[model samples]
Target: MTPDNFIQNQKQQSSTPYPYPYPPPFSGPQPVHFSQYTPPVADSSILSHIMHSISSIDSRLSKLESMDKKLDKFDGLCEAVDSLFTRVKTSESDVKKTHYSISNIKLDELNAEKDNLWIAQASGGSGSPGKGSKLKKEIAEIHKQNSELKSTVSDLNLVIRPSLAHGCAVWLPSSASSQQIL
Candidate 1:
Protein backbone atom coordinates (compact mmCIF):
# COMPACT_ATOMS: atom_id res chain seq x y z
CA MET A 1 0.00 0.00 0.00
CA THR A 2 1.01 3.62 -0.52
CA PRO A 3 2.09 5.87 2.51
CA ASP A 4 -1.12 7.94 2.21
CA ASN A 5 -3.34 4.78 2.25
CA PHE A 6 -1.41 3.41 5.24
CA ILE A 7 -1.89 6.71 7.18
CA GLN A 8 -5.65 6.79 6.37
CA ASN A 9 -6.07 3.12 7.46
CA GLN A 10 -4.20 3.84 10.74
CA LYS A 11 -6.41 6.89 11.39
CA GLN A 12 -9.58 4.87 10.70
CA GLN A 13 -8.50 1.91 12.86
CA SER A 14 -7.53 3.90 16.01
CA SER A 15 -10.32 5.63 18.05
CA THR A 16 -7.75 8.07 19.58
CA PRO A 17 -6.44 11.11 17.65
CA TYR A 18 -2.86 10.98 16.29
CA PRO A 19 -0.53 14.00 17.04
CA TYR A 20 1.57 13.53 13.85
CA PRO A 21 0.29 13.24 10.22
CA TYR A 22 1.72 9.74 9.83
CA PRO A 23 3.79 7.10 11.71
CA PRO A 24 7.60 7.46 11.85
CA PRO A 25 9.29 6.74 8.47
CA PHE A 26 11.11 3.35 8.32
CA SER A 27 14.34 2.77 6.36
CA GLY A 28 13.74 -0.91 5.50
CA PRO A 29 10.78 -2.46 3.53
CA GLN A 30 9.01 -3.70 6.70
CA PRO A 31 5.36 -4.86 6.53
CA VAL A 32 3.15 -2.07 7.92
CA HIS A 33 0.43 -3.05 10.52
CA PHE A 34 -1.97 -0.03 10.51
CA SER A 35 -4.88 -2.16 11.93
CA GLN A 36 -2.85 -2.87 15.10
CA TYR A 37 -1.89 0.83 15.60
CA THR A 38 -2.85 2.47 18.91
CA PRO A 39 -2.57 6.30 19.05
CA PRO A 40 -1.34 7.91 22.28
CA VAL A 41 -4.16 9.62 24.32
CA ALA A 42 -3.10 12.67 26.44
CA ASP A 43 -5.44 13.00 29.52
CA SER A 44 -5.63 16.75 30.38
CA SER A 45 -6.66 16.12 34.03
CA ILE A 46 -3.62 13.85 34.68
CA LEU A 47 -1.26 16.38 33.03
CA SER A 48 -2.67 19.25 35.10
CA HIS A 49 -2.39 17.18 38.29
CA ILE A 50 1.29 16.37 37.55
CA MET A 51 2.06 20.05 36.83
CA HIS A 52 0.34 21.13 40.09
CA SER A 53 2.28 18.53 42.06
CA ILE A 54 5.56 19.75 40.52
CA SER A 55 4.76 23.41 41.35
CA SER A 56 3.83 22.51 44.95
CA ILE A 57 7.07 20.54 45.33
CA ASP A 58 9.08 23.49 43.95
CA SER A 59 7.43 25.90 46.43
CA ARG A 60 8.11 23.51 49.33
CA LEU A 61 11.76 23.22 48.29
CA SER A 62 12.11 27.04 48.21
CA LYS A 63 10.56 27.33 51.69
CA LEU A 64 12.97 24.70 53.03
CA GLU A 65 15.93 26.61 51.53
CA SER A 66 14.80 29.89 53.18
CA MET A 67 14.36 28.12 56.56
CA ASP A 68 17.87 26.70 56.27
CA LYS A 69 19.27 30.22 55.74
CA LYS A 70 17.39 31.48 58.84
CA LEU A 71 18.78 28.61 60.90
CA ASP A 72 22.33 29.52 59.83
CA LYS A 73 21.78 33.15 60.87
CA PHE A 74 20.37 32.06 64.23
CA ASP A 75 23.41 29.84 64.80
CA GLY A 76 25.72 32.78 64.06
CA LEU A 77 23.79 35.00 66.51
CA CYS A 78 24.03 32.32 69.22
CA GLU A 79 27.82 32.15 68.77
CA ALA A 80 28.15 35.94 69.01
CA VAL A 81 26.12 36.05 72.23
CA ASP A 82 28.21 33.23 73.72
CA SER A 83 31.43 35.06 72.80
CA LEU A 84 30.18 38.33 74.37
CA PHE A 85 29.12 36.50 77.55
CA THR A 86 32.57 34.92 77.86
CA ARG A 87 34.28 38.31 77.46
CA VAL A 88 32.07 39.91 80.15
CA LYS A 89 32.88 37.06 82.57
CA THR A 90 36.61 37.42 81.95
CA SER A 91 36.49 41.22 82.50
CA GLU A 92 34.51 40.79 85.73
CA SER A 93 37.03 38.26 87.04
CA ASP A 94 39.94 40.58 86.21
CA VAL A 95 38.25 43.53 87.93
CA LYS A 96 37.68 41.52 91.10
CA LYS A 97 41.28 40.34 91.16
CA THR A 98 42.56 43.90 90.68
CA HIS A 99 40.33 45.23 93.48
CA TYR A 100 41.60 42.56 95.88
CA SER A 101 45.22 43.27 95.01
CA ILE A 102 44.73 47.03 95.59
CA SER A 103 43.02 46.37 98.94
CA ASN A 104 45.89 44.12 100.07
CA ILE A 105 48.51 46.69 99.03
CA LYS A 106 46.66 49.49 100.87
CA LEU A 107 46.35 47.37 104.01
CA ASP A 108 50.09 46.62 103.91
CA GLU A 109 50.86 50.36 103.60
CA LEU A 110 48.59 51.20 106.57
CA ASN A 111 50.26 48.52 108.68
CA ALA A 112 53.70 49.91 107.85
CA GLU A 113 52.58 53.43 108.72
CA LYS A 114 51.15 52.23 112.07
CA ASP A 115 54.49 50.51 112.92
CA ASN A 116 56.39 53.71 112.11
CA LEU A 117 54.04 55.73 114.36
CA TRP A 118 54.75 53.36 117.24
CA ILE A 119 58.49 53.70 116.71
CA ALA A 120 58.23 57.50 116.65
CA GLN A 121 56.19 57.56 119.87
CA ALA A 122 58.74 55.31 121.64
CA SER A 123 61.69 57.52 120.68
CA GLY A 124 59.84 60.81 121.26
CA GLY A 125 59.70 60.34 125.05
CA SER A 126 63.54 59.83 125.35
CA GLY A 127 64.63 62.69 123.03
CA SER A 128 66.07 66.11 124.25
CA PRO A 129 63.46 68.77 125.22
CA GLY A 130 63.78 70.72 121.92
CA LYS A 131 63.88 67.50 119.82
CA GLY A 132 60.91 66.05 121.71
CA SER A 133 58.62 68.99 120.67
CA LYS A 134 59.73 68.58 117.02
CA LEU A 135 58.97 64.82 117.20
CA LYS A 136 55.46 65.59 118.61
CA LYS A 137 54.70 67.92 115.71
CA GLU A 138 55.92 65.32 113.19
CA ILE A 139 53.84 62.61 114.88
CA ALA A 140 50.67 64.76 114.75
CA GLU A 141 51.22 65.47 111.00
CA ILE A 142 51.65 61.71 110.35
CA HIS A 143 48.38 60.96 112.20
CA LYS A 144 46.52 63.54 110.05
CA GLN A 145 47.91 62.04 106.83
CA ASN A 146 46.95 58.48 107.92
CA SER A 147 43.35 59.56 108.66
CA GLU A 148 43.09 61.17 105.22
CA LEU A 149 44.40 57.99 103.54
CA LYS A 150 41.84 55.83 105.44
CA SER A 151 38.96 58.11 104.41
CA THR A 152 40.06 58.02 100.75
CA VAL A 153 40.19 54.17 100.87
CA SER A 154 36.74 54.01 102.45
CA ASP A 155 35.32 56.26 99.70
CA LEU A 156 36.87 54.08 96.99
CA ASN A 157 35.39 50.92 98.54
CA LEU A 158 31.95 52.51 98.76
CA VAL A 159 31.98 53.41 95.05
CA ILE A 160 33.69 50.29 93.69
CA ARG A 161 32.14 47.47 95.77
CA PRO A 162 28.56 48.23 94.71
CA SER A 163 29.51 48.49 91.03
CA LEU A 164 31.40 45.18 91.27
CA ALA A 165 28.42 43.46 92.91
CA HIS A 166 26.20 44.59 90.03
CA GLY A 167 28.71 43.42 87.37
CA CYS A 168 29.44 47.03 86.30
CA ALA A 169 32.73 48.77 85.63
CA VAL A 170 33.28 52.05 87.52
CA TRP A 171 35.76 54.71 86.45
CA LEU A 172 36.31 57.72 88.69
CA PRO A 173 38.15 60.77 87.42
CA SER A 174 40.34 62.77 89.84
CA SER A 175 37.64 65.46 89.96
CA ALA A 176 34.92 62.87 90.47
CA SER A 177 36.87 61.26 93.28
CA SER A 178 37.21 64.57 95.08
CA GLN A 179 33.48 65.25 94.65
CA GLN A 180 32.64 61.80 96.05
CA ILE A 181 34.89 62.40 99.06
CA LEU A 182 32.99 65.58 99.83
Candidate 2:
Protein backbone atom coordinates (compact mmCIF):
# COMPACT_ATOMS: atom_id res chain seq x y z
CA MET A 1 0.00 0.00 0.00
CA THR A 2 0.94 3.62 -0.33
CA PRO A 3 2.38 5.60 2.63
CA ASP A 4 -0.62 7.95 2.74
CA ASN A 5 -3.09 5.06 2.71
CA PHE A 6 -1.17 3.29 5.48
CA ILE A 7 -1.30 6.41 7.65
CA GLN A 8 -5.04 6.88 7.02
CA ASN A 9 -5.73 3.24 7.90
CA GLN A 10 -3.81 3.57 11.15
CA LYS A 11 -5.84 6.69 12.05
CA GLN A 12 -9.15 4.94 11.40
CA GLN A 13 -8.22 1.94 13.56
CA SER A 14 -7.15 4.20 16.40
CA SER A 15 -10.38 6.26 16.22
CA THR A 16 -12.69 3.15 16.15
CA PRO A 17 -14.55 2.41 19.43
CA TYR A 18 -13.41 -0.55 21.49
CA PRO A 19 -15.73 -3.48 22.23
CA TYR A 20 -15.65 -2.77 26.04
CA PRO A 21 -18.66 -0.60 26.86
CA TYR A 22 -17.17 0.81 30.10
CA PRO A 23 -13.74 1.89 28.69
CA PRO A 24 -13.18 5.64 28.31
CA PRO A 25 -12.18 7.19 24.98
CA PHE A 26 -8.50 8.21 24.59
CA SER A 27 -8.98 11.89 25.40
CA GLY A 28 -5.32 12.95 24.79
CA PRO A 29 -3.77 14.18 21.49
CA GLN A 30 -3.23 11.75 18.58
CA PRO A 31 -0.03 9.91 19.18
CA VAL A 32 2.11 11.62 16.56
CA HIS A 33 4.85 10.57 19.02
CA PHE A 34 7.97 12.24 17.71
CA SER A 35 10.00 13.85 20.49
CA GLN A 36 8.20 14.21 23.80
CA TYR A 37 6.25 17.47 24.24
CA THR A 38 7.22 19.13 27.46
CA PRO A 39 4.83 22.07 27.86
CA PRO A 40 6.71 25.33 27.15
CA VAL A 41 7.82 26.73 30.52
CA ALA A 42 7.48 30.37 31.68
CA ASP A 43 11.28 30.72 31.27
CA SER A 44 11.54 34.44 32.02
CA SER A 45 10.50 34.00 35.65
CA ILE A 46 12.72 30.93 36.02
CA LEU A 47 15.65 32.76 34.43
CA SER A 48 15.18 35.61 36.91
CA HIS A 49 15.12 33.14 39.82
CA ILE A 50 18.31 31.51 38.56
CA MET A 51 19.99 34.93 38.20
CA HIS A 52 19.00 35.87 41.74
CA SER A 53 20.52 32.65 43.06
CA ILE A 54 23.74 33.36 41.14
CA SER A 55 23.82 36.94 42.47
CA SER A 56 23.40 35.70 46.05
CA ILE A 57 26.20 33.22 45.54
CA ASP A 58 28.41 35.96 44.09
CA SER A 59 27.72 38.20 47.08
CA ARG A 60 28.67 35.41 49.47
CA LEU A 61 31.91 34.85 47.51
CA SER A 62 32.76 38.56 47.77
CA LYS A 63 32.15 38.51 51.52
CA LEU A 64 34.44 35.51 51.87
CA GLU A 65 37.14 37.35 49.90
CA SER A 66 36.79 40.40 52.16
CA MET A 67 37.09 38.21 55.24
CA ASP A 68 40.26 36.68 53.80
CA LYS A 69 41.78 40.13 53.34
CA LYS A 70 40.93 41.04 56.90
CA LEU A 71 42.55 37.84 58.10
CA ASP A 72 45.69 38.73 56.15
CA LYS A 73 45.75 42.14 57.80
CA PHE A 74 45.38 40.54 61.20
CA ASP A 75 48.32 38.27 60.43
CA GLY A 76 50.38 41.30 59.43
CA LEU A 77 49.50 42.98 62.70
CA CYS A 78 50.53 39.90 64.63
CA GLU A 79 53.88 39.91 62.86
CA ALA A 80 54.37 43.55 63.75
CA VAL A 81 53.54 42.83 67.34
CA ASP A 82 56.10 40.05 67.39
CA SER A 83 58.71 42.39 65.94
CA LEU A 84 57.90 44.99 68.59
CA PHE A 85 58.20 42.38 71.29
CA THR A 86 61.64 41.50 70.00
CA ARG A 87 62.67 45.14 70.06
CA VAL A 88 61.37 45.51 73.57
CA LYS A 89 63.36 42.48 74.67
CA THR A 90 66.48 43.95 73.07
CA SER A 91 65.79 47.25 74.79
CA GLU A 92 65.64 45.47 78.10
CA SER A 93 69.16 44.18 77.55
CA ASP A 94 70.30 47.64 76.52
CA VAL A 95 68.77 49.07 79.65
CA LYS A 96 70.66 46.54 81.73
CA LYS A 97 73.93 47.53 80.03
CA THR A 98 73.23 51.19 80.56
CA HIS A 99 72.37 50.59 84.18
CA TYR A 100 75.64 48.73 84.65
CA SER A 101 77.61 51.58 83.07
CA ILE A 102 75.83 54.20 85.16
CA SER A 103 76.46 52.23 88.35
CA ASN A 104 80.19 51.95 87.54
CA ILE A 105 80.40 55.66 86.85
CA LYS A 106 78.52 56.45 90.03
CA LEU A 107 80.81 54.18 92.10
CA ASP A 108 83.93 55.76 90.57
CA GLU A 109 82.63 59.25 91.29
CA LEU A 110 81.80 58.27 94.85
CA ASN A 111 85.31 56.90 95.36
CA ALA A 112 86.88 60.02 93.85
CA GLU A 113 84.72 62.30 95.99
CA LYS A 114 85.57 60.27 99.06
CA ASP A 115 89.31 60.59 98.27
CA ASN A 116 88.88 64.36 97.80
CA LEU A 117 87.11 64.62 101.12
CA TRP A 118 89.88 62.61 102.83
CA ILE A 119 92.53 64.81 101.27
CA ALA A 120 90.74 67.91 102.48
CA GLN A 121 90.47 66.45 105.98
CA ALA A 122 94.11 65.36 105.99
CA SER A 123 95.31 68.79 104.87
CA GLY A 124 93.35 70.21 107.77
CA GLY A 125 95.78 68.11 109.96
CA SER A 126 93.69 65.18 111.21
CA GLY A 127 90.77 67.57 111.83
CA SER A 128 92.70 69.22 114.71
CA PRO A 129 91.59 72.52 116.28
CA GLY A 130 95.23 73.86 116.69
CA LYS A 131 95.91 73.80 112.86
CA GLY A 132 92.56 75.43 112.23
CA SER A 133 93.30 78.09 114.85
CA LYS A 134 96.76 78.80 113.34
CA LEU A 135 95.26 79.18 109.86
CA LYS A 136 92.64 81.57 111.21
CA LYS A 137 95.36 83.67 112.92
CA GLU A 138 97.35 83.91 109.66
CA ILE A 139 94.23 84.93 107.71
CA ALA A 140 93.40 87.55 110.29
CA GLU A 141 96.96 88.94 110.23
CA ILE A 142 96.84 89.17 106.44
CA HIS A 143 93.51 91.03 106.55
CA LYS A 144 94.96 93.44 109.20
CA GLN A 145 97.93 94.23 106.96
CA ASN A 146 95.56 94.76 104.03
CA SER A 147 93.57 97.26 106.15
CA GLU A 148 96.76 99.16 107.14
CA LEU A 149 97.79 99.41 103.49
CA LYS A 150 94.28 100.67 102.56
CA SER A 151 94.62 103.38 105.26
CA THR A 152 97.99 104.48 103.88
CA VAL A 153 96.56 104.68 100.33
CA SER A 154 93.60 106.74 101.57
CA ASP A 155 96.00 109.22 103.18
CA LEU A 156 97.99 109.44 99.96
CA ASN A 157 94.71 109.94 98.02
CA LEU A 158 93.95 113.05 100.11
CA VAL A 159 97.41 114.48 99.31
CA ILE A 160 97.32 113.65 95.58
CA ARG A 161 93.66 114.54 95.05
CA PRO A 162 94.38 117.62 92.91
CA SER A 163 97.19 115.93 90.85
CA LEU A 164 95.29 112.67 90.01
CA ALA A 165 93.35 112.30 86.76
CA HIS A 166 89.71 111.67 87.71
CA GLY A 167 87.28 109.31 85.91
CA CYS A 168 84.53 109.13 88.54
CA ALA A 169 84.75 109.70 92.26
CA VAL A 170 84.71 106.59 94.52
CA TRP A 171 83.84 107.26 98.16
CA LEU A 172 86.47 106.08 100.64
CA PRO A 173 86.09 106.18 104.44
CA SER A 174 88.87 108.22 106.16
CA SER A 175 90.20 105.06 107.95
CA ALA A 176 90.35 103.02 104.66
CA SER A 177 91.02 105.93 102.24
CA SER A 178 94.88 105.67 102.50
CA GLN A 179 94.92 102.52 100.21
CA GLN A 180 92.26 104.04 97.88
CA ILE A 181 94.58 106.74 96.48
CA LEU A 182 97.44 104.30 95.68
| Highest TM-score scorer | 2
Tens digits of per-residue lDDT for model 1 on 16-127?
6752556565676554566556667879999999999999999999999999999999999999999999999999999999999999999999999878766665576443
**Once superposed on the true structure, which residue ranges of model 1 sit more than 4 Å away at CA?**
1-39, 120-182
TM-scores for all candidates?
0.42, 0.44
Model 1, CA-based lDDT: 0.79
lDDT of 2 by residue, 88-168 (tens): 999999999999999999999999988876565555655454665566678789999999898877776776675465544
RMSD of 1: 27.6
Clashing residue pairs in candidate 1 (N, C-alpha, C atoms within 3 angstroms): none
lDDT per model vs. reference: 0.79, 0.76
Off by over 4 Å in 2: 1-42, 125-182
Candidate 2's TM-score reads 0.44
Q: After superposition, how far is residue 52 of candidate 2 from its true place, in Å?
A: 1.1
